[model samples]
Target: MTQEFGSQSTTDEVLAGVNLHGKRVLVTGTSAGLGVETARALAAHSAHVLGTARDLAKARQATSSVLEAAKAGGGSFELAELDLASLASVRACADRLLAAGEGFDMVIANAGVMAAPFGHTQDGFETQFGTNHLGHFTFINRIAPLLSAGGRLVNLSSAGHRFADVDLDDPNFAQTPYDPWVAYGRSKTANILFAVEFDRRHRDRGVRATAVHPGGIRTELSRHMSQADEEALISTINATNAAAGLPPFTYKSIPQGAATSVWAAVVADGDAVGGHYCEDCHVAAVQDGEGLRGGVRPYALDAERAKALWVLSERLVGEQF
Candidate 1:
């Protein structure tokens, strides 16, 4: 591990002396942004990378550089089709991987949607909850058998989780008014809780799971936001920072954004990261109340809350792990 790694670190810098020649990693949403950079970094370290995306063609095109880098580094890169919003697609993808009998050393659930207009997934849950949390929930649990012992699961959560905690009673906003930020917050919190529960369930087999915040990065995940909305959000964030005597808000580049994911997955100690939330290449502290500068909220890492959500998720998905 790089003792100096922090918010400004890039994926390559964190992995400078690391070798992954025989490792196999599964990274979702490799069609763009941090996913692409993450896959490239791992592959460059000679790790076999199996990346998934909602659109196969798009993924292939986006990952061309990754493939070239892998070849040069004596690694490999491949793509699989996966639509997180569709249970059928998730199941099919898992089934195919199982049938192929290939095992993975790590799974990075990087695909997710950001703030968007109110909507539902094909499975009838709110869009953000479905695609960001539930979809990965069903998919990862189904493919649990494929993860080798000592393997890791890295769920890409967000600092936005501070916006709100999970609303178990109204996850779909059924009786509650829908707000994009709130919905996003709920799903991101679920991401952390999922990791906490999963780590508990699988640690006996030497498998560990953790959630990470990529910090703020400009990417396709923000496609749903209008320019005006984006400006307003940034202004608000900067204002909040100014009040706290902290520096103004700034976004990390793709490599910098992805550094934490790879760091948590490959560099950080297994025991230290298991069931924890990380940001800026290190485990984040539990923070509560207003203004998301960094750190996770307590509710997201509550063990009891994690267990309850797992039960609720199984009921919603109509299947148990």
Candidate 2:
């Protein structure tokens, strides 16, 4: 079964017949783009959605857009605070949710920063690794109890994982030269490793985890890259497309890009199979080429590496689950 969808599928299409009237869902980075769309779609299906943003004000603004969409489709939404760069913020957000004692049926670790300038987060870790991986790691650890039985986790990774593997020796770039793209690549790979380990450790507890590469889409994720870098990437993509006898287009719309993440998180069929990397709404076939479409790299899917990262993450966040 080829469950792969194209760049034209909307959230509603991806979720056409699915319903979650009483299920609680949490979406991070809901201020815009794919995150906002995911939240809107879930809310439209009557799933209680808590969309997290760095600030409540911005989150509300984002929620308003989802609310408008939900009004037409029939559902509701709420806002929460989550600053992936700050462990304290992650703790606070988890605490707030836990205080409500509202168990969530799903958690989408969706908020992420892309190829930004070299910098350290409040935790003294590379910004991409810190926010995209560590933040979600800490949040999941803190909210382990809140994940209702049979809950699922969606870690949004990227095709960029092909560029590099998790640099356990220098995750923070503490002693190495920092290349923003490399850092982003490693972080994306970490996202997959996270799911691999999360599933390994938590499947027995009735929680499963997955990682997905929602195909390339135009979004704020590339904001930090210079025009030249983007052009170079586009050029590379175009060259590859041309070689494959395809068009020059390399990006998809927000809704199209969000389809796979939505599929992995909410699809009833997905519950039986977790810890796999997905693309276009289905478990990705392990690829082999090094130039373009490749399988999850050995390191990215390594159980040992995933476990090591999990241990390191627990130490950093002072939380264990």
Candidate 3:
């Protein structure tokens, strides 16, 4: 039976009565913000959570609260080093997990960078695209076999996917000028597409993938934005809503923002939600328009595009399954 949850739901509230004992889950970016809360909540429910960060020392310090939460709930917490911006680091992390030969019940691709200044990853892909999409793409695929039967993959996408679809011809913007938000939107779109295609290829293997828009929350993901950037973002949001005849934007608290992810990862029925994008703790509608008010863009869920991206990503990462 499918349960109905909403935007106001908290992580604990949504996961209430769900016993995750003996379940092993992997969560990225658990040093702070949504990732930390996500790990905390799952661990609180007696799941063994392996959380990742770029720097192990910093992650240990930053995730002290997660440790406390896990202790309180009699759950296990372990930290791993993972830097999505570096392919070598991604491989190293995957190697460790693969060597362990243990499988995870769920893997949450929750780490990502937001609108940042133009830069390239160590491998020379655009920062946002590289770190957000390609990085996770490579990491997840490499570790995919480690996902146990009936496992779930929850990708953390964003509502910003409405900003722009990916430019397959020029993902790195070699010719086109770089617009931070546009790049972010494209990466987010890729996130959704990754889930769509991943589910298609792996669902028969009992692995299901879904993308999630965790809602707007004040978190470190926006640390790259300045005061002016925030105002401009708000202005763009209000303008978009006005065009859509929708209500003004309202930000969600951290717990509220994480509701949908937790829902997708643990509470929701995997088969029903797989390959779909979710927000407000529910499946988001596919709305093709010039507004970021709500819902996902149709292009983000296009199966053909997802397949095309999967091919392109394999070529770019120089690996295939």
Candidate 4:
């Protein structure tokens, strides 16, 4: 059974009473926003956290801040290089980790770009699809060995996935007009599908995976959004929250936004049950409507689609496992 912690629950609250001494955690997109919160919370619990970012210098700065906070709270942290937009970078980062002979108790695939103007990664793939989905896909496969049995993997997905399915024929936007929201939706869907397939393939090995949608929070993640676009989204969210008699979509603080992820990683949920989509500090229920205003859409939970995407990903990344 899953429990719902409201938007008020902070990462520290979600992680309350859990002791993580000696646990090794790796969190991507750790330079800022919820990523930093995840890293900070983990480290604060005595977990040795390795945070990743695209820019080495920026990552160092961010790591320093997190480390300072961790130290203040009597915790520890480290930094690493990981650019989700570049497969080469992802592979290189994985190689570095492997070289260190370090084993991770958890790998939090939190790095991702949201709706951004049309662009491509260094690999010629569309930016959102490449960075949000493919890079993590390749990264996990590359470091699958370091994930000790019973290790956890968490993928950060979004409610925006209610918008679209993967366009297998044109995942890279090579033949079709690019819509940033649709691109983001596709990538987020890939995140969920990835966890489903990953759980299926690796659960027997005592490994498990989960996907999460942290409730909306204001953060630097909106940097790519236009002022108009941001205003529009905020209006829509506020309207929905108001209708629900909720607090006008103030939604979550950064620590709150990172709560569900921390909970999923450390909770003793009985033997690494995988392929679950979580939100608000618990596994979310599957919904069946199109244009789902809230909650996970059916398409995101479809087992068939999940498995199919796995095959497609394996083909794209050229990895046997």
The local distance difference test score of each candidate is 0.95, 0.83, 0.92, 0.83
Per-residue accuracy of model 1 over 1-321 as CA lDDT, tens digit each: 537689999999999988999999999999999999999999999999999999999898899999998999888999999999999999999999999998999999999999989999998999999999999999999999999999999999999989888998999999999999999999999999999999999999999999999999999999999999889988988887888788999999999999999999999999999999999999999877577777889999999999999999999999999
**Model 1, residue 227: displacement in angstroms?**
1.5
Query: How does residue 254 of candidate 2 score in lDDT?
Result: 87
Of candidate 3, the 10-residue stretch with the lowest lDDT total is 1-10
Candidate 3: Cα lDDT at 288: 77
lDDT of 2 by residue, 1-321 (tens): 234455577678888877778899988999888999899888888788888989778677756878886676566788888899999898898888889898998999999999888888898888999999999998987897898888999999988887788887778888888888788889998999999988887888889999988887888788887889888887887777677776775677888888888888887365544878887766776654454453466677788888988887777667777
- After superposition, the stretches of candidate 2 with alpha carbons farther than 4 Å from their true spots are 1-7, 241-249, 271-273, 292-294
* Candidate 3 TM-score, C-alpha based: 0.98
Per-candidate TM-score against the hidden true structure:
0.98, 0.93, 0.98, 0.93
Q: Between candidates 3 and 4, which one is better according to TM-score?
A: 3
Superior by lDDT: candidate 2 or candidate 3: 3
Best by lDDT: 1
Task: Give lDDT: candidate 1, residue 194.
Answer: 99
lDDT string for model 4 (1-321, tens) is 344566578988887777788888989998888888899898888888888898878777666667876786666888888888888898999999899889998999988888989998998889999899999999988898898888889999998888798887788888888899899999999999898888887888888998988878788777889889988887877776576666665557889899888888887372433788888877788865544355787778778998888888778767767
Which pairs, if any, clash in model 3? Answer: none
Per-residue accuracy of model 3 over 1-321 as CA lDDT, tens digit each:
356788788898898888898999999998879998999899898899999999788789888878888898878899999999999999999999999999999999999999989999999999999999999999999999999989999999999998899989999999989999999999999999999999999999889999999988999999999999898888899999888777788888888888888899888888889999999888898887786768899999999999999999999899996
**Model 2: clashing residue pairs?**
287-295
Provide backbone clash counts, one per model.
0, 1, 0, 0
lDDT rank, highest first?
1, 3, 4, 2
